[model samples]
Target: MGFRVRSPQDFWGGIVLIIIALIAIWASRDLAGMRGFAFGPGTAPRLFAGLLAFCGALVALVGLLQDGPKIGAYAIRGPLFIVAAILTFALAVRPLGLVFATYVTFLVSIMASKEMRLIESVIAAAAMTAFCVGLFTYLLGLPFQLWPPFMY
Candidate 1:
């Protein structure tokens, strides 16, 4: 008898996770890991990536053992907007600063959701932007521009 995937969705999901984990691991490989007794910058990412790979394997194993629903068609809207938001943040963060970039990113990401409320999104985005500003600036002591250079 041919081996068949009992749970197509879980199997596919697990495969996707594994792919992501592998990408993460590959991405972090160049960074420093354990430096003798001290943990380096890449330690957490490498560890987490390994853990994710293990979890993905387990999920795929479960998929092989258990029955599941068939995989459905992929949605484009959410992923498209999410990618757009990431690109927006990356492009906007430098010239626009954190506040405007973050707010715009949030707004763009919210457009992907069907149940998004404009007022709530605005309020939430504002609060998150303020929190990030405070956290990165005051607590972390990282120098970040709150507004564009032209504005100041």
Candidate 2:
């Protein structure tokens, strides 16, 4: 945490959070009034907004008091094959549907694991995919396609 924020621009994260909090407050404003007087629709938003402003201000204050000279730059540098494997599930889902996506995601996730063996990967992927299909399709009845369906 070496980075020093000199201006609001440098500390733009808090601004974004504040804006989001404000919007949530505004959106929920008409629902109810303050918590103590729950008599009107404006109560809920006012109470929520007040809490949001409080937390946002607290975060901003902490940012201002922290040390300077940001040390490490953050990045995601996982293997390209790993990423491709994950994307494979997404690609398969539209054409192959939920059953395929679940199976592919399982396969990709197993391959993505650092120490996975090929045989174990296959078994684990199959088991996980089956469990997911059962839970989502049978138990939850989410209305997702189990097999590829004709699209117009």
Candidate 3:
């Protein structure tokens, strides 16, 4: 079989997805599974994990067949800042509220890209923050504090 990886990113991404799915399956193994006519705690989780593995395999196969862009040099700044943004949002959401936390997170994550302009990023972040707040609080009907507790 003459197999060549056409999309290194997709190939590696699929491999990671498979590994994550395997880990999820392993972690849920101790939970109760199917018994007789009813589903158990682990049934849905294991089923989803199997589906994820299947999708990952499909992605890997596509990478092997289709031609795509070559892999570029890895950049730690992007991942690092993105993780930081996530952490910031998690830590600040309760204290700073949804509006502030979302904006801050967007700003932090935007810093990961070198080509992003400050003005454009700020505008985009504001728009995204408004959308998220509206979607979560109004559309989804979830109770999310929009502003700081002290503001009320």
Candidate 4:
């Protein structure tokens, strides 16, 4: 009813975000040795992580200053599923390659959406996968394996 989050869940959410941001910033700090130009791999993460951490801390401060809600009101569902899916994707990437992993992730996401029919979702995922694979592999010449030699 108000122009604000309805519960304390959001404040705690800010805390979680701050933790994630701190972790990213900490991880990136180890890459300080890569002192390259804007093209360095560490450059973007360092900047991004620092920004995230700063924003997260600011959110926490604002929550503290205001009569913010608490974390207990939030609902967390299917966290295990999300974590498992992420782990699965990481494990599958090298062997199944980018294209296949993309397809699989798309399909899993669509099915997990709980709003689409299985066949319809599969078709849509396949189309999107084809489009992405075509763009990255054929058009941009980004070298990534879609499937192993025998599977392709």
**Candidate No. with top TM-score:** 1
* 1-152 per-residue lDDT for model 2 (tens digits): 67556444324556666887888877875575555645577665666777877777766666667644443454343365567777887798888888778777776666555677988877877888789888988999888888888642
Work out the TM-score per prediction: 0.55, 0.51, 0.54, 0.52
The ten-residue window of minimal lDDT in model 1 covers: 141-150
lDDT digits (tens) for residues 4-87 of candidate 3: 898877887788899999999999989999999889999999999999999999887777778877778988999999999999
Q: Which run of 10 residues does model 4 get worst, by summed lDDT?
A: 72-81
In terms of lDDT, the poorest run of 10 residues in model 3 is 62-71
Model 2 off-target regions past 4 Å? 1-13, 29-38, 68-73, 77-96, 107-124, 131-145, 150-152
Clashes of 4: 2
lDDT of 1 by residue, 1-152 (tens): 88999999999889899999999999998999799999999999989999999999999999999999888888999999999999999999999998999999999999999899989999999998889888998899998887898999
- Using lDDT as the measure, what is the rank order of every candidate, best first? 1, 3, 4, 2
- Candidate 4 global CA lDDT score: 0.71
TM-score of 4: 0.52
Ranking by TM-score: 1, 3, 4, 2
lDDT scores of the candidates, listed in order: 0.93, 0.70, 0.92, 0.71
**Cα lDDT tens digits for candidate 4, 5-106:** 443555566778878977887777756445545456667787787787777777766765677656643233345445656776788789888777877777
The local lDDT score (0 to 100) that residue 17 gets in candidate 4 is: 82
Instruction: Look at candidate 1 and tell me the lDDT of residue 3.
Output: 97
